[model samples]
Target: MIPVADAFRSGGAQPGQDALALTGFAAEGARAVFTVAGAEEGASGLTVHYRTQGEETATVTLLANGTEVERLALPGTAGAWDTLETGVPLRAGLNTVTLRTASGDNGAFELSGITVADAAPAPTRGAALPYTAYEAEAGTTDGTVIGPDRTYLTVPSEASGRQAVVLEETGSHVEFELTEPANALTLRHSIPDSADGTGIDATLSLYVNGEHHRDLELTSRHAWVYGEYPYTNNPAEGSPHRFFDESRVLLDEELPAGTVLRLQKDAEDTADSYTVDLLEAETAPGPGTMPDGFVDATERGVTPDDGSDDTAALNEALAQTSSEGLGLWLPPGDYHISDHVNLTGATLRGAGEWHTVLRGSDGLGGFFGRGGTSVVQDLTLDGGATVRDDAGDHAAFEGDFGSGSTLQNIWIEHSKVGLWIQSPTDGLLATGLRIRDTYADGVNLHRGTANTEVTHSSIRNTGDDGLAMWSESEAVSDSAFRFNTVQVPLLANAVGIYGGHANGVEDNVLADTVTSSAGIAISTRFSPVPFSGTTSVRRNTLLRTGGYEPNWDSAFGALWIYADTSDITAPVVVNDLEIVDSTYSGILVSWQRTVTELSVSDVEITGTGRFGIEINAAGSGTFSGVRVSGAAEGGLDLTGGFTVERGEGNSGW
Candidate 1:
């Protein structure tokens, strides 16, 4: 991927660090050229990230090596950055790719970046190949349509298409026709909770065509929360909210396109009501296999699927693998562990998340990585803990990895936390992680974690922040979170940066923050170290974020900048943000002491409950290319000592 600012341009294209703003299109021969170094290139896929507004679509001509390749129509995004992918021919070494206006109508747009790869990027482990999402409201339903609303905290507001179907009566159902062949399906739904607030188990029946296919077990145990920050499952403390959970299942046979899939609340179903949000269908890949030269854990007396304790055997296998300098492999079965397994300079592999299962009960313990390179992948960690245990060291995985270490394709559920990495670790890449139902933060880089990255992961139903970098003892710098989807965090922000430097949150989608904070937050609340370097928040989409803060008796913004504990004195850049259906303000800048040098550019705010941009800090900033619509309390409500040098193309104030 190459940023547009790094490319060579002509004909009045304004180049900036965040994007290339194309203007003066009436000029002759206006174009931008990119030099791409390809490795053995033949046929490659090209993806361009760009943003534009207005009703008219833009047209760009693509030329490779000075030859006309294709004319691409760039659709207007209503001011949000979107991607377009196409096939491009390339030579082995250096290739010059150029984009020029193909039509007389300029229809301005900003180019963010472009990526050229050998093919379309491969899907992460357990992700649906050729995935297609169908919204419940768009399907044929005999149920009640609940909302396009976001004000009610107890109802889920971050649903796709901003509305959902509620099946309140028995036999009420929603049906959708498959557009492609699929063998696996994932349903996002919410059901009424039990009166006592411990959650309830229910069932929903699936029908293929007119025949009964299967029954799905749905539970509210992983959803719903109440009370203050770092919330609780008990209802008496506060109003209940965060009302959604997901369930996935693989079919016995692949269904053909045009097959009618139906979800019905039949008489046998246990729930009083079922709220259907969305369904995703995909053709899933086959299970994984153990690689050669790896030591199988069964050889060390570890018996799987026997419902017996395998903790001792797994620990012995770990020690042997560490001593022999070999990787440990667990085959396709369930292994029960009652205590934590220590991993030192070890690699543990499993036969895919759908096959290998590590289950534990109340005394459930996690895997701890220490010393040299520790790699864990392709397994499910099921901490069968029913409730939050604040004092328990029950994270599914804890401690930091050595340089060049990774945790990949791992599924963690019902744990105190997931993948809590400690300080001083660098170059730890965590990708393809599915962490849900965690009592606390899903992934937390705690202090001094530098040059690490978390990408292509999914996290939901976390008690605290879904993904966070807390610079408590040492500044967590030079880390990044990109291309991840975080949804329905029951408390706090979806992504939180507490006093980090040179850290970036980019190309991520965050939605449905329940209470106490924003969707993406940059704050000085916990870190003791002074802020330094530039903090970047770019190209992120926030949906239905912001909720009431009980302690402050107020609400937050969808994207918040707050200096609570210390003055934020570093340059912060927020660019290419799209905030939709914000429950409160779209963007909030507040400080207790002082803040300086904030730059916000190329943002779109739609359907905000309060002001689009609310500033209450003692700071100066530059704002540009910001557009807001459907804000109830107007836009740009500036107060306090905050001053702005307003840049070009700002409206809706």
Candidate 2:
């Protein structure tokens, strides 16, 4: 009968006591704020709820009562924020009402006792309850949806409207269609992981009457694929599932009356069998009133295309908005942008990642973020034109939120640079920001920023680097580069986290079969020298390096910490490493003036045709816990190693 969000505090003014169940908070460059919510009500128009302690201040207004009674700010601030009754239409006997605050605010409020009748009921007499309608689950279905933001759906699937539709996995997309059109509608779905995980690489999308509804993405991998992805080893600690608000495929959409809702698999994937249940649908309640909504804070399919395709819009929106408890929305369509799009504190609700179609028109990039809180997801951001030619900012999505706030769940692709960042502080928690199908860098971290972390995601198919995290300054520490899929098809020097600070590159899957600039290069000509931090290159699975391009040269694996005369005294602790199935030489450690710790343990190199450990280290270091195999030449090309105390080489060290 009662809406879930309405489960916050309900009774009269109280201390810790709450009425309904509440959740979520917005932080100012801090950890997200979450609290307990409860509510209680009486027969009169007055009702109350309880609030929890949060990191910031939050406000709560009455949904059912307001007019007659003005907002009743509690006497003093407590763990709870109260909601007083006002403008309520109270009748005799018992009554029921609801409250709402469609934002990142608390769900708790204060409930007042009732005075239904002019005169109170006789001491012994009791009053009956009034008529109240409960919420419903009518015209709706479940399942993860993926595709262009604008055109998210098509028609109903053969398995439409049966059980309950749940998550719309990202990598796995789906399509849906409508027979006719309907009124206001609400669909329920789930987002597996939240923060601290490799973000759920899944999505849920909805298409209404051939148009796109919303594209949703899994923000954190806490729930869905826990322990599924390595980089996202973010333990599912005390984190809870977060359901964000996304722009509907159609805003205040007025379908052709009798809209047919559908759910299916997205592009590049098969229809994952799911349970689809009809939630509810209805007409617009009033002006400024949002209809049914659901989203994965990571993405929303309902975005503005302007000219760029659906995906482009989604990408732009993601980089621009930090959806307040809502995901970036992008509808399906080929959005064509003429000028550069700067992102801000907006929440773009859209379809699944990599599905929203976004194409640029001019040489300018599809999306740009100078600063502020920006996030893009569930769409394709094409660099427009071809490679080598339209090369201005390969970054389909370029952001210099220098010192600004950039959070997670910003998926990008189909551009020279899927994502490029040059932030000021480390607020840019670019977790799960992937880049796919491109000619250049999937994700490039240039300019120089610190406290950045790129974890639990992948970068495949590009003419250049798959993912790079380079910063010449001391700012790039506490920064990490892990769990990525690096594959360069055209053999254009595909690398993962090239140059700059020797950030933490662990749990990544780098496969540079192409003769790219080494699998994960610390390259020959690196700027800003190197960083001074524990380059914990651990638990990575590398496959093949340097071969696709005949013109390409040397290729390295796990790490290529190259920087001469640069004070990079920090050790390169390569542990739990596995370098199997490569095309060229296993690893080549080159020119380095600074002598730091280079402990290689648990190193396994199998199926390599060339020398396994070609250590050209002029600096002093130790090679321990190393394992190599299938090397025609001697395994360790030890040129100037400080010590080879303990090692296991098949041929020689």
* lDDT, each prediction: 0.78, 0.44
The TM-score obtained by model 1 is 0.79
In model 2, the Cα lDDT at residue 367 comes to: 64
Output the TM-score of candidate 2: 0.52
Deviating ranges (above 4 Å) for candidate 2: 1-27, 32-329, 389-394, 402-413, 431-434, 473-475, 489-502, 546-559, 565-567, 592-595, 647-653
**Model 1 steric clash pairs:** none
* lDDT by residue for model 2 (421-446), tens: 77554445454454544545666677
Best by TM-score: 1
On the 0 to 100 scale, the lDDT of residue 281 in model 2 is 40
How far in Å is the alpha carbon of 165 misplaced in model 2?
37
What stretches of model 1 exceed 4 Å from their correct place?
Answer: 1-118, 121-130, 151-153, 157-162, 192-199, 224-238
